[model samples]
Target: MTIGVIGGSGIYEALPLENVSTKSVSTPYGEPSEDVTLGELGGKEVAFLPRHGEDHQHTPTGAGYRANIYALKSVGVDRVISTNAVGSLREELPPRTLVVPDQIYDRTKHRTPTFFGEGMVVHMSFAQPYCPEMVGHLAESAREATDADVSEDGTYVCIEGPQYSTKAESEFYREQGWDIVGMTTIPEAKLAREAELSYATVAGVTDYDVWKDDSEVSLEEVLENAEANQESINAVIEHAIRTMPEDFESEAWSALEGTINTPTDAIPSETRERVDLLAGSYLD
Candidate 1:
């Protein structure tokens, strides 16, 4: 099975993939953040996509979440591993800690979060946003492959941002018990479930958010820590891909089984064509 990777902040270049080639995939939603980089990593076929454009041109809210997920799914990717740079909401989970989040809280208000809204209605089970099995594998990989603190499960509060949180907002999230905060992950995770692709993220804490009295988030600080965390993140990703079971199965693969509400016959032809790659089997 081909593994897909969505590289977030500070991860602009393609992974160290052998026999690398690039494919420009056009999705029904739009263009992906960039062309998909295809190659082999640790004896596994891998497709790496930068969540932002190659030069980091796209903002969090501007990144084409739907197109990115659909493009990966189009390329025969069954599972996706995402990397993110986040701010710590808790003191103990300071900078450089790698968190494998099992839950997500969406604080995004503007982005399109689904591919089923226009002509079809599908209510995906999102109680557990990230794939549990994938989360386990990622946590295990981080533990074995890097010396960074590996947090098994945490709630990642994803806010809509090209901006960091204000002190008040940060404190509120802390009160709600969210562990780490980041800009991406909401529509990405949501769309992955809709696409029936197993998905999980290894989030690296880049800074202590403004919740801490003297601490404040800054681009320089975030970039520095993200750079520091890159080696560890890369190690964990490689290990996970190298050691993953060939026949690993996930509940996410059948996520759409009973989720579609719009009858197949009622779905518009254009909309059906748009979602064909994702729900054609069920609709047929």
Candidate 2:
């Protein structure tokens, strides 16, 4: 089984996967952000993809959430661990902290957030939103690798952005009990579920959102923290890969079962072949 790591923002490069090689791939959805880096990590074959193009040209809305997940699935990835840079919503969850969020509250408005389209439709169960088993592994790995305080349970608010939040908006999220805020993750997580890949997020908190009166957020600050904390993040990922069990169950894996709303006879043969990696068993 191949594992996938979707690196966000500053994490364009992963800790050198042993015997690494890069391969560009195409999926029915579109091109992925960049060529997938394939290599071995902790004796397991792993695939790595950068959410944004190598130059970070794609905006959050422009990132092809559908194509990205599909590309990973195409390459035999059954589970994915996504890294995100987030803004802190609560005071206690300060800047430079690490969090493994268990839930996501989507506030994104403009983005292609689903794989089902045209004649296809699906209703996926997202009660937990994240893979609990994966989150638990990440939490333990983070604690072992970093001295920075890491929280196990958090509610992430995903916003539509190339812009940071307004004070009122930030405060509103805090009122909703969200621990962190970011512009990505929701659609990517949702699409992964649709693709039948177990997905989890390891969020790196860069700054206090607009809710903090003491200091405002900035791109420079975000980049700086991401750079400083990367070593710890890499360490955690390596440890997680090393200690990951040979086999485990993920409720996220079964999320798409019985959720397809379209009749099988109505599905186009071309789309079926393209998506066989995700739903071959169900379709058969």
Candidate 3:
């Protein structure tokens, strides 16, 4: 039961893993953000990938969403815990608050949000994007591990960006009742479902965004809050991994059971080979 952790801003390093070894994994999609770091934490095998590369070179749109998810899946990761630095749309959810979002709204315009396309197609049920069980575990872990406010559930509105949101855009998201605004999570969450891996995120609020009259989102401010929140995020992740039950079962494991649309024989050989890791069993 190897758990995969995708680190967001200010979280390039993972929790102290034992007997750590780094592995560079190439996928059919392309290269992963960085080498997958493998180690043991709380007696569980863990694989960690930095979402934006170790040096934060990749932008949200440029990060290899398909490759990263594929790489983790290839390395025997059955569950993924993603950490994100996000801006709060609500006043009450202030900086340093940790949110376990159960819902996601894709405001992203430029990203491939699926692993199945071209010669193969899968209509996976995404009514509930995040794995409820995983979300519960993360939320409980945060409450037990941190004194910072933990939000059990909320909507994460994912936008396309290297740029922060405009004042109008920020206000619109707030009007939509979204809790947090972030750049990543759209395609990552969508692709995880396609790969049959349980996935959820611990979003650490870094700023109030541009919605607040007196608040102006800045890199310095976001980084400061993210650094401060890293301690709590690390604690929650370590505790969750340590206490996770080995026999845990997720509906995501069978997500491809009846979702593959193309008949096995009809799929192009090249396309079939490309998706073999994700949909091969279903195609058979």
Candidate 4:
């Protein structure tokens, strides 16, 4: 029942992975964002990968998404809790807030969003994209773990970035009721589903974007809030892992069984070989 946690922005390094071990994984899709740190947390086995690499070298769009998800799957990680630093769109969820987003609206472009490509294709349901049960457990953890106001559920809008959105785009997101905005999470969530892993995001709100009338959202302010919020995020994670039930096998891993829709015969040999570690249950 090992769980994987992909630490996103301002989380370039995870608290020293206890009982540390290092694993270099090769995925059918290619290499992951970085080497994975395998260790013990809450007396349970766990794996952690820094999404932006150890030095935060990769941008959101530059993240090796397919490989990152595949590496987790390769290590027997059945569920993932991705953490990201996002800009708060709502006033109540201002800087230093924590949100466990239950839904996502994708606005990203130029990235592979699924594993079924080449000779195989599968259309999976994303109606309830993030895993509900997992999300509930996380929300509870955040509430009990920190003093930071934790929004139980929120809509996370994922946009292509290297550049923040224009004021018009930000306002449009507000109109659609988006709570936070970020550059990652879409294909990460999508690929997690394709891998049949229960996935959810614990987003750390670091700023009120430029849309805030009186406040100027600057990188300095974002960094300041992000630094302030890290301790709380760490608390939530530690507490969540400590209280995580021992039956992750039955609940979280079950999704991996029938979720793959690609027909066996139709799957290309190369793709199968490349993803053997991940899709072995269905392909083998």
Candidate 5:
């Protein structure tokens, strides 16, 4: 029962661990952003993957969400803890604040958000996007490791972006009372639900989005805040790994029992082997 850690933006370097080995995993979806680094952290086995390539080569839209999650699931990672750097939509969630968003408002226009494609069809309940148990564990670990402002829950507005939001767009999100804005959470959260893995995000507030009349958001500001908060983020991940339970039950795992719509005989031979580990039990 290994744990998975996905590093966002400024967190490209591998998590600090002892006895680490990098492994490459192939998934039906495609190649993951980077090789999975397997190692021991706080007496627990863990795997780490950088969402963007180590050099930040992948754009938000180009990040292989399906392959990444599939690779982790294939390697037996039952739960995932991801770290993201995002713009704040609310004034109080200023730079360097830590947020564990409970909900995601997906405004992303491009990207495949599921694994049951090809000839297969499936539906996953995403009403509660993030895993509740994982959220609590992440938040508690963050609080114990950092003195920075940490929030347990908020509405994360996920947008399609290789470009930052326009002022009007930022203002619109604020009007909707969303707590944070970012480019990566949509399919990442959505796909995790389908994979039946407990997933949680630890978002580091970088800047107030362009909506803030007092100050315009800038790359420099975002980078600076992200750099400052990176240590705290790492601490929370290490702590969470240290204390995580070995086994757990969730509606997420149970929900997969009936989600597969394609018949075993109807599926192509290649497709069945490709997706078997994820949804094979439900098929004939």
Candidate 6:
């Protein structure tokens, strides 16, 4: 019954850890963001991984989405809290604010985003991409842990980029009414559901996305703001781990319940081996 914490930009170290030790795990997909750091936080067991490499080696598209999620699941982590740095599309949600976004709009183009493929076909529910249990627990923790105000709900717009959005692109997103924008959440959120894990993201607003004529987005600016807000971000996660709901379960996912399209016996042996940890029961 361990909880997983995936650290994003300007957040590579796992805070408030006790009895910390780094554990290396290799999944069928490959190695997770570096090694999984096993430790105790908030009276519960935890597995922490840097979403990008230790030196911030991977970009959003370059991060190991499948391997990262798979490594956590393999270590018996059924629930996850992912942290990200985002640009605010609306002025209502200002920079340095913490947000638990309830909705997601994917505009990303280059990522696999799933663990199931090959001879077997499995479909997952995307209606509520983030887990309700996670959202509730995360919000409760943020209220007590951070001095800053935490937005309970908002819509996240995911883009494919190492580059920040252009002014025209940023303006268009505002017209679409998206609350926040970032690069990594699409497939990371999508793959968590496919693996039958409860997942949520805590987005820290670092800029206004170049839409505001007075302000423009830049990596140097994003990193500076993110560093300023790291203490609050770290506190929310440490407290959230102590408050996670005990009854949280992924068994209610109907799309994952019986949605395998291929006949169990007909799945190719190689394909079965690759996805055995993911949808093996359906293929068996």
Error of 1 at 35 (Å): 0.7
lDDT of 3 at 109: 89
The ten-residue window of minimal lDDT in model 2 covers 8-17
Give a tens-digit lDDT track for model 1, residues 1-284. 99999995344242567898999999889899989988898789998899988888999999999999999999999999999999999888999999998999999999999998787899879998999999999999999999999898989999998889999999999999999999999899999999999999999999998988888789999999998999899888888998988878899999999999998899999999999999999988
Q: What is the lDDT of candidate 3?
A: 0.91
Model 6 Cα displacement at 205 (Å)? 0.3
Model 6 CA deviation exceeding 4 Å by range: 9-14, 250-255
Considering summed lDDT, which 10 consecutive residues are worst modelled in model 6? 247-256
Per-residue error (Å), model 3, residue 256 = 0.9
| Poorly placed runs, candidate 3 (over 4 Å) | 8-14
lDDT of 4 by residue, 1-284 (tens): 78888885344254545788889997667888888888887687888888888778988998899999989988888888888889889989878889999899999988889877777656667877788888898999999989999997889999998788788888999999988999889799988987878888888888877688887677888778888889889888777777887755324344456666678887889877766665677677
**TM-score per candidate:** 0.97, 0.95, 0.97, 0.93, 0.95, 0.95
Ranking of all candidate structures by their lDDT, best first: 3, 1, 5, 2, 6, 4
lDDT of 4 at 126: 83
For candidate 2, lDDT tens digit of each residue in 1-284? 68898985344365657897888888878889988888887788888888887778899999878888988888889888888899999888877789999999999999887777666677878888888999999999999977878999889999999999999999999898889999889799888888888889888889998888897999999999877768778877778877778887887777778988888889888777877777777777
lDDT tens readout by residue for model 6, 18-135? 8989888888787777898888876788988888888789889989989999998888888889999999998888889999998999999989987877877876668888887788
Candidate that beats the other on lDDT, 3 or 5, i.e. the better one: 3
For candidate 1, what is the TM-score?
Answer: 0.97
lDDT of 5 by residue, 1-284 (tens): 68888886344353667897888998878999999888887788888888988888999999989999999998888888998999998888989999999999999998899887778878767888999888888999999988989999999999999899999999999999899999988799888888888898999999998987887888899889988999889888878888887665556666677666777788887777877888777775
Question: What would the TM-score be for candidate 3 when compared with the true structure?
Answer: 0.97
The lDDT values for all models are 0.91, 0.84, 0.91, 0.82, 0.86, 0.84
Off by over 4 Å in 5: 8-14
